[model samples]
Target: MTTKKYADFIYKQTKGVCNIMVEQMFSDYVLYKDGKRIGALYDNKLLLVSTENLNKLFPNAVQEKSFDWGYYKLIHIENTEDKELLEKAVRITYDDLYFQKDFVTDISYLFKVNKRYQDSITKIYNLHITFLRFCYDKGLLKINPLDKQDRILHMNFLNNDLTENGTKIFNELYDKWLVYTDKNDDKTDDRIVNTKMLEKYYLSIIDKLQINS
Candidate 1:
């Protein structure tokens, strides 16, 4: 675990050289530069992110494995009073990992499209409800939110517009919501609950993907 003091020290040290953001992950703090992860602060030590490029650059850097699938070299920045050295190390790592454009922009754009599609589908579904209400008011057609048109519109939106991963996530949440619906008999109300759950999931995935970029 990274203490707040240690994490702040590393973050403050790199201030003039580049922008760094610290993220808390299961009690440990990981640092990112330009939307790309640069290092992690674990056990009060700052270690540059391990990669083939980093390995080549610092061959003698010790290999410290933090988990089953990953390890990184000690950047020798821990508790050091040498600001110049700290600044230089941060600059090199940031420059090496930084890209011309951050991938977050693309993810944001993708979600914007997804949001537009979701909004359009919702409007259409509401329009159908309004039409059905108008018809019923005029004694033309009796309808509810679960009418045939509603089902068809929902299925088309799910199958055609949603990506495979998105579909999988939605299906999983939908299955759970199905259980809730079975017990409570209120599917429409649970839709809001499921939507909130999906929003959190999507945000987490986007953050992970952006950091990995």
Candidate 2:
């Protein structure tokens, strides 16, 4: 299990130097740069991945073998407090492992993935509104467009259709929409027909109608 303190340490050490995000891989926290796996935190220690460029960058860097795998050699970072040294090691490893083509491809792939995810959420919301409209027509719902309270219930029903993060965002949007609607309910002149004219027309339409005698 990766500890927050250990993960935070690496994130802090590399702050403003390089783009990095600490992620857990197989119970070990690994650092990624431009979608490349560059380093890892194992047993509460930071280790830069062993690669040709890493070996070249730090010729005297100590290589330790993990007990999990006999042949796997990892460069353990002993001086955890040496920010400058740590940054240099990480920077060199990142540079060496960096590939322009792979970087561009990964970025494009990420964009496509995000776009598809957003589209799916939009589709879900469209269906959700359609379902709510049906319910409103059947006199089962009070709000046609749905209020936060109703939306929360609808979201729960379709929870499996969304990612955990997506659900949180959707809920937040629901709250915002509720607040906005509450604020603008009386201010906005959004009604199509005047209530007085509508009521009068409905009430007197039969009296004003001519019969074909």
Candidate 3:
């Protein structure tokens, strides 16, 4: 059984990261960052989502099944007293869960296609939906996936938080959208076909990421 004192100690060790939250589950505790679950204190042990970056950071950390029936496993962190490492581990796990590295690589490929030839609106819309779905599934974003207005609001929030590369990518995508719209003359049939193709591409990326995760 895990004590509140031990759970509090674990939470304290990982306190500096932004939006870190914890919830008690009977005797154990689950940890979250930016609304995504990153780790937990179970049976007095610290268990974090296993990822390539995390594995490299703590090569000797023991990996174990999260549950008897689940395929996903977690890394058992032994040294909870090292506050800096604990914080780093939580951040790494959260990031890996939030944005799988391979997803970035796959999206970059789409960005490389000629702007004049790409279906920019379809691509952008699908990308937005894909991002929202991923975040929603991971408990990072809260909104009905089917609600257009809510999606628009949250997507705006995401756009506001874009990194340098992210901003550049969005700009390129917007330019492509303008080109596609001008060329297509707002044809519904053409838009539908483009949306279908982009949907398949985005879904494949999600499938690959989930399989690896």
TM for every model, in the order presented, reads 0.39, 0.42, 0.49
Off by over 4 Å in 2: 67-73, 100-213
How much does candidate 2 score in TM-score? Answer: 0.42
lDDT of 1 by residue, 1-213 (tens): 779987787778776665668888887887787566777777887777554555555566765565322443445334346777666666567655553122211213333454757754454344334333332332222222145544422212212233334333434433443343333234544443344544454445546545321
Error of 1 at 122 (Å): 40
Between prediction 1 and prediction 3, the one with superior TM-score is: 3
Could you give the candidate ranking by TM-score, starting with the highest? 3, 2, 1
Worst 10 residues of 2 by lDDT: 100-109
Provide the overall lDDT of each model, using Cα atoms, as 2-decimal numbers. Answer: 0.50, 0.54, 0.61
Q: Judging by lDDT against the true structure, name the best candidate.
A: 3
lDDT of 1 at 209: 49
Candidate whose TM-score is highest = 3
User: Per-residue CA lDDT of candidate 2, range 118-212, in tens?
Assistant: 74444334434544443344333333446655452432223333333323333333333323332223532322212343333323432444311
How much lDDT does candidate 1 score? Answer: 0.50
What ranking emerges by lDDT with the best candidate at the front? 3, 2, 1
lDDT of 3 by residue, 38-90 (tens): 77778889888888899989999987664331555788989888899888888
- Residue 25 alpha-carbon offset, candidate 2, angstroms: 3.0
